[model samples]
Target: MGIEFPKVRVNSLINAQTRNWDVDLLQALFKPEEVQLIRGISLGDVSARDKMIWPHTQSGTYTEEICDHCKSHSEDIVHALWLCPCLNEVWEADTGWSFRNTVRWDDFQKLILHVEEVGLDLDLFAMIIWLLWHRRNQIKVGNSATSLGQIVACARQQLQDYNLVQPMKPATESANLHTAVTWSPPRAPFLKINYNGAVFQDSNSAGLGAVILDSVGGVLASLAENIPLPQTVADMEAAAVRRAIMLATDLNLSSIVLKGDSEIITRAIQAEEQSLASYGNLIEEIRLHVDSFLNFRITHVKRKRNSVTHRLARHVSDLVVWMEEVPSHILPVLLTEAG
Candidate 1:
């Protein structure tokens, strides 16, 4: 007859001091067949608390010593998500979403707990980490590296699409209810510079558009330039910001208000925390340019309020600069906003 033992822990059958199975305990608690199976389990030399073991690997361990992409540092969750050199571009492209320097945790679970405690966008944060891991796996499988811009775009679009399909929360609904829908001119003595970026995927390039307007909504200067594709949408937006600053400097404008439709890039510029993301360098450059002005402020607006720059950004031109006048195509939007 087969013997059935009550629920017994493996630790109970092991002698703590000897770090070996207690034959007497095993025999008393389990049948001969069960004892034989228990004896097959190997014991470590040093006595320690029992841990969950992964059965798939030969070492029965899940983590690796070095990162598969960089092949240098240990492949821990933190290293894979935030510290890996190979992920620099990917993280940089996500400028405003990082909390690396401000937060610390031993493992991914604790990090997530910390993120939740701080009221950070956990969904976006998790999405980026997941995408990063997916990217790492793609590289491991010998797939070509995806562009930074594409990856960033994918992460943001996925998040946006997900949020769109979800039921609107009361707080979100309230915020959207109060959002400004029409363009407004900046207050006295501050010329508003509205900049935007547009990706020309078919051409494998991007466009930068900036339109500087006075307090009365009259266009001061506008520019549209084509450039080689950037690694991420944030990169392109950062470039657009730099171009806008350059235009302001060229005009010798000191007090200015910079506006854009990208909340991420705008917030990144305004954030007191130093960015370590790939777009960090570009953002720093923008800051340096910003310091040259006596009164400079960066703000974000909805896409609807930034139609002129959006139209200009979609321009498929090499380089076009208008001083004190905008293109004919933008006249309707400008007139509508002014009226």
Candidate 2:
């Protein structure tokens, strides 16, 4: 609880309407055991005034700090996670990674920003820091500290396991197979909206395309728009989705399916947990637009299946919208799919 959740009340940790624990906030603030204990307390249906209670006190009243595992006078999150003297061997060990000592930061947020600015592998940095905190908890419970080698190996193995389960990219052998398969129309009532984004480095701009098609593969509407380039390809792809949602709203279309080729963006949108990536805000906005539809789904497809949208996105010279017809450049792809 330290400085992170100072004087936080029980009511603040739960959803009032749903009457359920806020899983994300709990995970962020407490260790696994503490999270489970907090979640075990059943909430009453009757609304009552919330009062502060200290778990360590017998009468459930506020008191002085009970846990002082770290005797250091200036111990903070930055110190416990990275700057403590006990963690020196763990950080200095030959873990096939480097930790910068010259850079100075006062808090955990500033340290993370510095890591991102210096082009350090953020995933690895996060993994090591999490393991360090886990180890600190173990020590607090009188458990023997794990060796530096064991800590490094655990982090690497966890990372490797995580990557193995992620969506795989199309292999060279399957590229031709995927290209030969044409885009298929969505079933009954649902309109399929295929979107793609293109980056124009020379012009320092990006393009977005979205085409809405009905069950019989007839174009309901299509759009191509240009805007100043974003910081990354993921941002542009997210923008394409936002524009597509806006267009659907403009056309008063519901029961829609959104398809795109970016596995990263698609996965982020589909996840239950809030995204923490740089383009998280854009993803959140897209989620809000999606909630307006009666039925909404987002899907990922191979680039070849999204050829029509890809071509439209490359038409970045001007903003264009078509009704019941696509641009001339997209005709060949439509014909190919139909044939």
Candidate 3:
């Protein structure tokens, strides 16, 4: 029940065959690990159940199922797991591990389960499922998502950092500490601006941003936005970047900071996630925006450092987890590291 599945989807997938989602799907999706789990994860008291296929969508069907991202028919388990090009990047980003292009439906289960039993982080194993479902949802909804690298990047920001923001030190004290007649962590403009996308299903998607004065206190912009956006959240983030840059331009400030919780979008802006094909256009858009700024620079920052924006983003989530019992897809899935 602690799992982050949408209740409607969860209930639609299950009725009452059994409640062992972990064991059922784990066994069905992964065979090699069944034996490994016999002694693998040291949580000695756990039990594996055979009828544990939790609420879920089956892979592959003779009936033509169209993928939302690609115009191709959704080819069941094989396509969802190992076939889609969109998912290809997710695997590498998720594990720094990749699968051969030849895996089949039966093999996918093995791979899915294999990833589980291989003595990895439990959170990681679950993230693979969440990510897979996310891609599947994208396909179902007719929207495009970034590469798996991008999705992994998205998950990376969901991690929660409990630390309170460090209070600003007095300029006199900070100067004394940094400029101590010794070496200084020279601060020309360590400032970073962070943004977040507050997306609402079937409604407007908004973005939030703030300017931080390096490790110290930060200031929130008076601006808040809501605009009609394309289906995919990454696209929304891309748009958010555009908005951030526009805001910076309007402020007429040079040497300003740019930041966001979206690593895929950030990477696209940084040109790290670009190649010859898919992301080039988006990258160019970001570059054009960057060109408009005089001394503006963009960098990645942890979501924790960008708390003000997170608060700003909370206002407009239409289908964004209304029930207290479940977590919304928009309500980020926190990962251990930021890409």
Find the 10 residues in a row with the least total lDDT in model 1: 51-60
- Per-residue alpha-carbon lDDT of candidate 1 for residues 162-271, written as tens digits (9 for 90 to 100): 98898856987765554545567788779999999876645656788999999887889999988765555666787789889989999999899999977778877998
The C-alpha TM-scores of every prediction are 0.49, 0.49, 0.39
Q: Pick the candidate with the highest lDDT.
A: 1
Identify the superior model by TM-score, candidate 2 or candidate 3: 2
Selected candidate, larger lDDT, 1 vs 3: 1
Put down candidate 2 lDDT per residue, 33-126, tens digits, no spaces: 6775565343333353443333322222334522223565354566677766566666676543355465444435446645665687788778
Regions of candidate 3 where Cα sits further than 4 Å from its true position: 1-186, 202-220, 272-283, 317-339
Angstrom error at residue 299, model 2:
0.9
**For candidate 1, what is the lDDT?**
0.73
RMSD of each: 25.8, 15.0, 20.6
lDDT of 3 by residue, 1-339 (tens): 344434334233332444223444344344753533321211111222222221122211124466543567555555665566666666655443543443333334335434544565546545555766777687567788555656665554442221235566999998665434321121565444556665443343344433323333323243455544433445555555655665665656466667776666665566543323222344455576667656666666655545455554554532221211112332232111111
